[model samples]
Target: MSRKPSNIVYAAADKVPLGTLISLGVQHASLALLFVVYPLVAATEAGLSFEDTQILITSCVIFMGLATILECWPRFGSGLLLVQIPNTSHLPLAVQSLAAGGPALYAVMSLIAALSQLSLTFFTGALRKLFPPEVCGVAVTMLGVALAEPALRRMFGLADQGGAAMDLRYPMVSFAALVVIVVLAIFSRGPLRLFAVAIGTGVGWGLAHYVGLTHGPTGRALADLPLIDLPQLGWPGLAFSWAMLPAAILTGVISAVDMISTVVSMQRMDDADWHRADMNQAARAIRPNTVADMGAAVTGGFASASSSAAIGVAFATGTTAWRVGVVSGVIVVLAAFSPRLIAALSVIPDPVVGAILVYSSAFLVVAGMELILSRRLSDRRIFTVGLAVMAGLAVAILPELVDATPDWAHPILGSPLSVSTGVAIALNLLFRIGIRQEASVPVTTDDNPFEATTTFLEHQGDIWGARRDVISSAIPVVAEAAEMLLDTGVAEDGVVLRARFDENDLDVTLLYRGAPIEIPTLRPSPEDLLGDAAAVARFVGYMLSKRADRLLLGRLGERQTLTLRFEH
Candidate 1:
C-alpha cells in the first residue's frame, strides 16, 4: 500500500488548511491598510494632492502584491518564498530624501535599491556567511531600535491632520487595541491568536467610528481621486546625489538581509532546513517581490516586502506552504483593486497602527534578543557582544550625538544589527583564541575548565577519540572544543585528531588546531531534534534555558589538547 502523504509534503504542495489561510488573509488586509495610510500621510507631507496620493498608494499596493507573488513563485525555479512589504526602514530616510530632493529623487533611489537588491540576491551565497544568526539578530534589533521613535511619534498622533478625522491618539483607542491584541495573542488558543494584530486594529477602528471621531472623506477630497487609471512607471528625473548612495545602499542591504533572514527563520519555524527545501523552488519565492517592488519604486510608490509573519500563521495552524502566502497576496490584490475600500481602511488612526506596530516591533525585538542569547557563548563573551549591540542601538536612537560624523557612518555605526554583530564576531574569535591557560592540564570532569581537557585526553587513546566522534556528530561543539584546547595548549601543536562516532563508522576530522575547519558530519542528535521544536515555539526559548545548557554544552568548552614533540 502507498504510504499516506506527510504534512510536510502536503504543505509544500500548497495545501494549507483553509482556516489558517483565512486568518492570514485578515492580517494582509490590515497590513495593506497601513500601506495606504502611512504612504498617504507621507505623500501629503511632500505636498502631493489627495489624487496624487491615491495614485501613488494604489500603485504601491500593486507593487507590493507583485513583489509578494514573485517571492512566492519563481519563473526560473529560484525564489525565496518570503513575504516582502513596504520596508519600514525607508520611512525615516524616505521622508528626509523626499524633503531634500522631492518624490522624484526618492523614486530614483528606489531604482538604485532594487538594483542593489537584485545584485545581492544573485550573490546571496557569498553574502550568507557574512550574516549568521548573530549578525542578523543584531541587524533586526537595530531596525526596531531605529523605528522606536517613529512608533512613538505615531503613538502621539503626529501623522493625522485633515484626512479621515479620527483621533487615533485617544488613549482608549490605542490602549484598548493594544490590550485586545495582547490578550488575544497571550491567551486565545489556536487561530484566534494569529489574528491578534488584525482584531486589535479592527476593534480600534470600530471604537473610533462609534465615538463619532472620524468623518468620511468628502467634497474636494472625494472629487480629487481618479476612479481608475494606470499607474505611472518610469525612471525618476531627480538628479543623483552621491550622499544618497549610502542611504540607498543601507536600505537595499537591510531589505535583502531582512528577506533572507525571514526566509531562514521561517524555514526553521517550519522545521524545514536548507537541505530538505527545494532550493530552486525556495529561491523562486521572492520573484514576485522583485517585480512589484521595482515597479512600485519607479512609480512614486514606497517599496514593500513580505513578512515572516507567515511562519506564525503556519506554526499556529500547523501548516507550512505557499498557499497561505498566496492567499495573503490575493487579499492584498483584492484590497488594492478597490480604491474606496483602500481609502476607508487607510483612515485607520496612527495609534491603531501604532499599537499594532508597537506589539509587532516588540515581538521582533524579543525574537532578536532570543536569537542572540540562544547561542552558547561565555559570560565575558556575552557581555562583549551585548555591549556592541547596545552601542549600536544607542547610535541609532541618538544619531545627533554623532552629528559631526559623516552620514555614511550612521548606517555602519548606528546599526547595532551590523556593527555590534561585527564586533561580537570579532570578540568571539578573540576570546576563543587569545585566552590562555596550562597546555597539559586537562579538565577531566565537568566541574572545571580543566575537566574538559581531561575528558578529551581520556578518550584520545580510544579507537574513536571523543573529540572526533563528538565533533562529527555536532559541528557547533567543535568551536567549544577548540577554544578549550587552544586555551590549554593542546591544539597549539597543530595535530589533527581522528575518531569514529560509532563502530565501523568512518573516521572524521572534527577540528583543525590553527585554521577554520569544515567538518562535514550530518546527523541528527537528540539536541538537534529538540532544537527544531524549541526554535519554532520561540527562537530562543529552550535554547537559552539553563536546564538545556547541560546537555547542549559540548565537551570542547573545557577540554585541552597537549602537543608534545621530541627528536625521533
Candidate 2:
C-alpha cells in the first residue's frame, strides 16, 4: 500500500524512534529560527524599542510552534512535514502596515489575511483544476528560486544592513557546510542520512565559530540573557483599515498559493505513483497554515507562511516523519522562552544558514521540474509553464518593474512566487477556452484504420491536455479495436471511435451496429490462436485488455459498444 519512493526512510505516517525524532526536530527548528530575521527587520522598520521588538519576535516563535503542532493533525493540517515560518512574502506589507498605523494596523492586516485564507477552504475542489500540475509546479520551482538571492547573499558575507563586500572566508565556511550536507544527504545512510541537515549545520556552525564568522549583536550579549523566562507580551491592538484590506487579502491568497504548492510537492515526494494532486488533502493542508495566520492576529506576531525550504531540508534528510514535526514544534515553543537560546540561534552564522538553504533549494527546484513534466505537455501547456516561469523570474530579475507597481500591487507583483503562480493560473484558465474534453472520428473502410484512429486520438489528446503516457497507452486500444471492427465486416457503414476525458479517467467507446467485440478473460494459446479466426480475434481482445486499464463490452439501443478506460 505504501508507494512512497525508495529513498524515503520514514514517511509521514511511520512511527519514528524518539532520538531520531528529537534530532530531526532540532534540525528543522534550527532552520525555522533563522527566519526570525524577517520579523526582526519588520520591527526595525516599525521603530519599536529593543524590548518590544524582542516581544514581537517571541510571539512569532510561540505561534510558529503551535502552528507546527496543529499542522500534524489531518483534521486541522496538511499532515505532512510542512513547517510554518514568518512569511517573507508579506514582509513588505508588514513594513507598510507598521509604518502606516503601527503594529495595530499590521495586526489588522494579519487578521484580514486569516479570513481571506479561511474563505478559500470551501473552494479547494474548484481551485485544483484552475491550478493544474504545471502551474503548481511553477510555483513550487519558484519557491526554491526565491531562496537563491538571500542564500547567496548570506553565503558571500552580505551585512545585516546592506552593501557589504563579499568575504573570502564566508564562502570558505559555506562551501565546507554545503559539502557536509550534500555528502551526508546523497552518500550516507541510516542515522547519518536522517540527521544530515542538523549534522551539516552543526559542522558549519562550529567552523564559523572557529573562524570568528558568528558575528552578530546577539552573540555579544549571549551570557547576559536568562536561560529560561516567560516571553514578554506586547499586545498591539487590532484596527482594520479599508486601504489595507486589499493588500492583506492578496497576501492571504498568495500565502494560500504557497501552501498549495508546498503541499503538492510534498504529495509528490511521498508517493511514487503521484498522478495528479489530491486537492482535498491539499485544502486540508492549507487549513492549518491559514490558522497559523490567525495565530499571528492574536499574538501580535508577523504573518506566517508554509516553508518549502523547511520541507526541502526534510526531503534532503530522507525522512518526513510527522513525529519529528510534532516534537520540533514543541522544541520551538520551548526555545521561545529561552532568550539565550534564541540569542544563540540568532547568531548562527549567516553563511551556514545560507549553505543549508542552498542545499535544500537544489532539491526543491528539481523536484518541481519532475512535477511539471508529470503529464504530457501540449503546445498550450508548454507556453503556460514557460511564460509563468518568466513572469516569476521577472520579479526577481527586474526590481524596477516591482517598484513601479502601485501600493496595492505589491502583494501580487512584488514576489516571484506570487506573480509567477498568479500568471500561470490566469493563463491556464484563459487557454482552456477552445480545448474540447471530448472528440470522435468516423472510421471508413477506405481509410487506414491505424492512421485514422491515431490521428484522431493524438490530436484530441493534445487539445484535451491529456497525460503523455496515458494517451500513448490509450492509442493502441482504440487502434486495435478500430482495425478489428473494419476487418471483421460487422459494421453497417463503418465505426465511430469516441473519446471522453475528465481528471481521473480517459474513456474511449467504439459505436458500431455489430456484435460486441468479445473480451476473453483467458489468454489464447498458440494452438487456440492457430485453430480459427475466432481464436485469433479473441487473442486480440485479450491483448487489448492488457493494454487498457479497463475494457467494457455492451450495447446501447441499436449499437453494440466496446469501451476502453484508461486511468488518468
Candidate 3:
C-alpha cells in the first residue's frame, strides 16, 4: 500500500494563493501580537511609564520581524517556517534583572547573553555530545512547570494586586478563554483553527469589558494614542560584573536549547522524513537570530527566540510556507509603526494573555516529556531527569529556598529552569564518565541517525573486507528504510540500527518495539507513488529492495526486525 500527500493545502513552499497568503499573514500577525504580553509584563513589574512600555513593544515587534526574516532566509535559518518573538522563558529572569537595576541592567545582561549564544554556535558540535535529548528535555519540562505558577497568578489577576484578594470575574474570564481555545483547537477547521488564540482572547476581553473588569488602557487612553510613532534609538548601557555572569550564561544556554527544540519540532512537522535534529542546520539558524536578539536588546527590547504560538498557528492552518512567514514579518513591521494599534492591542486583559501562556506551557511540558522518552529510558536517564525536575520544582515553588541562597547566586538559583538545566547537564556528564564506552553507539533523537548509521556501516565493512561499492550502496538502503519506518510513525520511540559483519557477508538489522506494520513489496506501479500514505510506504519498500541483495521483514512476538544483507 502507498500513501498520498496530505490534503492540507499550501502546507509547504510558495504554493498558496495570494488571497490565502494575506489571510494567513493576518492570522500570524495576530499570534505575534499575543507575545506583546511579555514586554508589557516586564514593563509593569519595572513600573515603567506607559510611553516607555509602548516604546518597548514597538522595538520588540520590529526586532521580532527582523528575526523572523532571518529565520526564513535559507542561509541563516533552518529553512523551515518559524516565527521569532520575545521569549517568555526569559521573563522571570528579565523581571528580576530589571528590578535589580532597571532596564539598563536588563539590556546589558541580555546583550551579554545574546553574545554568549552567538559564541555557542561555534561549539554546537561539542555541545551536542554533552547535552543529549534527556538532559535538554528535563530542563525544558522544568521550565514549563516553573512557569505555570506565574500563569496562574495572572489568570487570577493577582499579578498586579500583590496577593490582595482575588477577583472572581478574572478566573471566569480566563477559564472561559481557555475553554474556547481548547474547543477551537480540537474542533475548528481551516482558518478558524489558526485564529483560535485570537478568538479566545477576544472573547475573554469582551466578557471582561461586559463585567466592567477592563483595567488597563481603554477608550480615552487609546484615543489619546498617537496614530504613528517610531521607537527611540539608543545604545544600551554595558557593565562588566562577575555577579551577573552565571545568569547570563544560563540565559544563553536556555535560549539555545529552546531554539533547537523549536526548530527540530518544526522540521518534524514540516517533513515526514524527519528523524533527528540537523545540528548543523540548527546552529546556522540560531547564530544569526542570536545576533538579532543582541540587536533587539541594544535597541531597547528584550531577547527573542522562536515562538511556539506561531508554530501552532502554522500547524493549525496548514500554512507552513516560507512566504507566509515573510508576509507575517512585513505585517509585524507595519504594526510596529502604529501607536494607536499598539495601544489597542495593549488593552488585552491579563487573564486572556495568561490563558495563552498556560496553553503553550502545557505543550512545552508535553514536548519535553516526548523528547526524554524518545530514546531508551535507561535507569541513569530516569534518575538524571527526575532528580533535576524535582529539584527545579522545589526551588521554583518555595520562596524560602530561593531566599536562603546567596545574593550573588540569586539570579541562577532563583530560576528553576536554570537550576534544573545546570543540574541535568552536570549529572549527565558525571554519569557518562566510565559507562559511556560501549560496543554499539545508541541512536536517539539527539543523534543524527543517518550519519551515525553510515559511519557505523563503513567501519564494519572495513573489518569484514566488504567491497567499497557494496558498503557505499548499503548505507543509503539501510538509512532510507529506517527513515521510512520512522516517517510512517511505525516506531514507538525510535529505531536502533546495528550491523554485524562476517567473513562472507555484512548483515544490518533495525530493531523496533512498536505496533505491527505491513511491509510493502519491492515493486509498485506509478500510481502507488502518488496514491496515499500507504503508497509512500510501498515506494520505500521498493527503494530498499532495489538497493540490497536481500531484504527481509519479520516479527517476534513483540519486537519487529528489518534485515538487509550484502554478500562480500
Best by TM-score: 2
Which number leads on lDDT?
2
Worst 10 residues of 1 by lDDT: 559-568
- Candidate 1 structure quality by residue, lDDT tens digits, 1-568: 1122232333434555677667765566456555555566567677765555665677677767666655555353233335556665565556666767876788877778767766665654544445445555665565555555556556656554535564534666778888887787667766566566767778988886676645556567865755554544344456567888888877766666556546654554444322111223333444445566667776777888656444333433334455555666667766666655566666676666667666656656665665554433445545655776777666666767567677665545545455555565565445545333212332222334334433543433221212232322333333244344444343435333333332112222323233222112343344543553322223221322221212221235333222211110
Backbone clash numbers for all candidates listed: 48, 0, 11
TM-score of model 2 (CA atoms): 0.94
The Cα local distance difference test for each model comes to: 0.53, 0.82, 0.71
Q: Candidate 2 lDDT, tens digit per residue, 346-417?
A: 778888988988876787788779888877778998899999999989889998998898878877787898
Instruction: Please give me the total number of clashing residue pairs in predicted model 2.
Output: 0
lDDT for model 1 comes to 0.53
What's the lDDT for residue 244 in model 3? 70
Query: Can you tell me which runs of candidate 3 are displaced by over 4 Å?
Result: 1-14, 40-57, 88-108, 237-239, 315-319, 440-568
lDDT of 3 by residue, 1-568 (tens): 1121262345545466787777777767766766787888888998876666665666788888888877876766666677877777567667777677766777888887888777877886676655566765775576567657777887998888985888888899999998898788778787677667668878998998898777766678777977887765555465455667677777787788667767765654566533345667778778867877788787777777887656656655655777787777788878888878766766677887778767767866776786676544556667888888988988877879988877656666776776887788888777666552212444555556689778877665543334466678788888787777777666667887867754246678887877544455546778876776667777777777667888778875677887888774
lDDT of 2 at 460: 82
Q: Which pairs clash inside model 2?
A: none
